[model samples]
Target: MMADHENAGYRRLFDGDGLTFGTGFPLTDNRTSRPPVERELELAAHAESVGFDALWARDVPLYWPRFGDAGQTFDTWPWLSQVAARTDEVALGTASVVLPLRHPLHVAKSAATVDRLSDGRLVLGIATGDRDPEFDAFGVDREERGARFRESVDLLRTVWREDFPQVEGRWGDLDGELDLVPEPTTESLPLLPTGHARQELEWIAEHGDGWLFYHLPESTLESYLDDWREAAGEKPYAMAVRSDLADDPEAGPEHVHQGFRAGTAWFREYFRRLEELGVDHVLVSPAGESPEADLQRFAADVIDRL
Candidate 1:
């Protein structure tokens, strides 16, 4: 269950001990080109109305031709702000923001702005970064990214939580001169670190409010959850999956990249298993031929049943 002290974003997705569900942006089948922005907003509102606890957007700063998929084709900050304006409830999240590529100060300011605009409904997911070409393109030393990642997280926390806080690190030096304007709805917005971020599990647990990782099988998930409990007891753990729902509700499972092609019956059992394994939240990409219909079906057939 969500603790009383956690902010709106944290509580909305994890307000209880059972599993909660959320979906990502781009709300359409066309990944090669831009999606219809208006339609995306409609689907986002629809998602909230149908009982999804949160809505996520990805941070793909540069569209690498080889990478082949542009995430929402919009920058994270403005896109989230637009989404925030359209929806009244439902927590807003970045599937993750690449901390190493962007300046921590800008990240802190933008996040706080969105958090305030959305009425304390932002859950910021930070990552060390993944794409090698992006690292080179940004002129950031890939080897030093881990250190930068650590530095950025430390810096962001201080700036958000303390007024005119003093800090010095590889990123830069701050001497309690000026504060970042427009503080978050809470003292600080929750930061959920994505994947390992080239740090020890212990370090992640100590610094992050929660953990966001890719999908895993039930056994692996249970193992990870055990480690999580030892490192950070009761701190929420979330995972993501890319799903393609089958037409038959009773159809069985077939493995795909980091997810599955399954039917409603299989999804229900799988989610129930995740709940048993202590997974606090699940972020899904329901990529059926008709995405809007898929979302509705998943909510009605799977989420409602759960």
Candidate 2:
């Protein structure tokens, strides 16, 4: 059985860490060409073997060609459930699920199922969603997504905590009330908001367990951290970086999205700087490289170094 979020075990898993490390899936180039799902899982297990702390999956319901990045080729719910079942210790997380596109009932059920299967190792990241095609396909409005996201989150929480909780929101209303049976292993699942999503810092700090950010420079990171701290009070912060490590030790820093293309030595220094800046966790994406080998190399060369 899973423990509650307030449980000591849960705290140790998420916050009481020696700096957690994890990999984001997609296993493909921005062009959507790369290894298969089996290869990706193999690499994910290898990441666990090499002492990584977590494995994160992304939801890409619709691949917008212009968006450049088609996150993890598979659907998210099943993928996360499978990954959770396969891995023993590594925490499983969704880089984010587009809450506005799916019903809160579905979100609560799916997340609870994963958390139960993973023994409370699930970290749920929620987002308002940006892809217009996905919204259109689901017959939802893109402009109203932010409102929907807040409503869905509120409803999901109610379903988890209260028995037969009623919900009313812009999307719709649940009058009879519904409870998520076989509640999450943890009393409450950790929810990290991806980007601002039209929410205020105060709301994020008061409600979110953590914050997830994209690529930002070191200078920007400092200010962002300050803001996060100001709002978070005591909650943790996480950031993702895209890296392509090379064999050359002296490779100069090449600009990537939120990270850089550098050798292990530079990578070590960069992570150390992030740690110094009070980042609680850092997840990396193997930008256009062999997912398994590159992630393993990074774990051994960079993660282990810290």
Candidate 3:
């Protein structure tokens, strides 16, 4: 069972100095249209060998045609379990799991099982979910997901803490008072909220152990950090970026999503800038083909430099 480290405080899991680097799973190959899950694992193992801190996967149920890219292209739980068994030291994280779409008991059980198997090396990132098609297909109301996300979080926590816990919330009520067996190794799971998710910034600051932000320009990163710190008091913060690395060392910057398309040299410099701005960890998604090769090269060259 999880311990009682229930005090609300920001826990420093990754510092910018050591610098954790992670790549999304089932890495896409825009050039050849190949998804090399095995190649991705080989590269992830290489990342662990080189001292990259974590590996992340996304829970993308339905591929929305409008949403340019399909993330990871793997089921979240099985992928994470496979990665955990393959690697020994690197931490495992979900870029995020859409909380409102899943049952809280399932979330608690699956996450705890992975945590135990990983020997307490799981970092859970939760979100209210953004895809309209997924909500529609699941018969879940996108409009009410924010409220459901909050309730789901509460239920998961309650189940993790008390054996056969009874939960009453907007999502539903559990009356069995049945315990969720095999609790996580940590007293409380390390859950970082992705964006505000309909919750006020103050509530996010007060409740979230860490906050996850999407795209923010370099100029505004510091100011945003300041606002987040003000609301968060002392909690840590994390961010994700869609990056594509160029083979040409002299390649100029190209626009991706939250990140720039640059050579390894420029990527290294960008991470340094983030560290200077007090960003703790930056989860990078490779945007083009050769994600595995690019990530391997990144771990060997750019990641170590930071």
Give each model's whole-structure lDDT.
0.87, 0.76, 0.74
lDDT digits (tens) for residues 18-127 of candidate 3: 44556556555432233567776776787677656777788777777688656677678878888888888777888799998888778888988888887877888889
TM-score of each: 0.96, 0.91, 0.89
Position 2, candidate 1: lDDT: 38
RMSD (CA, angstroms), candidate 2:
2.6
Scored by Cα lDDT, where does model 2 land? 0.76
Candidate 3 clashes between residue pairs 3 or more apart in a chain or in different chains: 30-289, 164-177, 164-178, 164-179
Top model number, lDDT: 1
lDDT of 1 by residue, 1-306 (tens): 433226788888877767899888887756667888998999898888887889999898888878887788889999999999999879999989999999999999999999889988899888988788999989999999889999998888889889998898877888989889988878777999999999999999999999999988778888999999999997899999877799988999999988998999999998888888889889987745787788888998888998
Per-model clash counts, in order, read 0, 2, 4
Return the number of clashes found in candidate 2: 2
Deviation of model 3 at 19, angstroms: 3.6
lDDT of 1 at 269: 90
lDDT of 1: 0.87
Off by over 4 Å in 1: 1-5
Alpha carbon lDDT of residue 257, candidate 2?
65
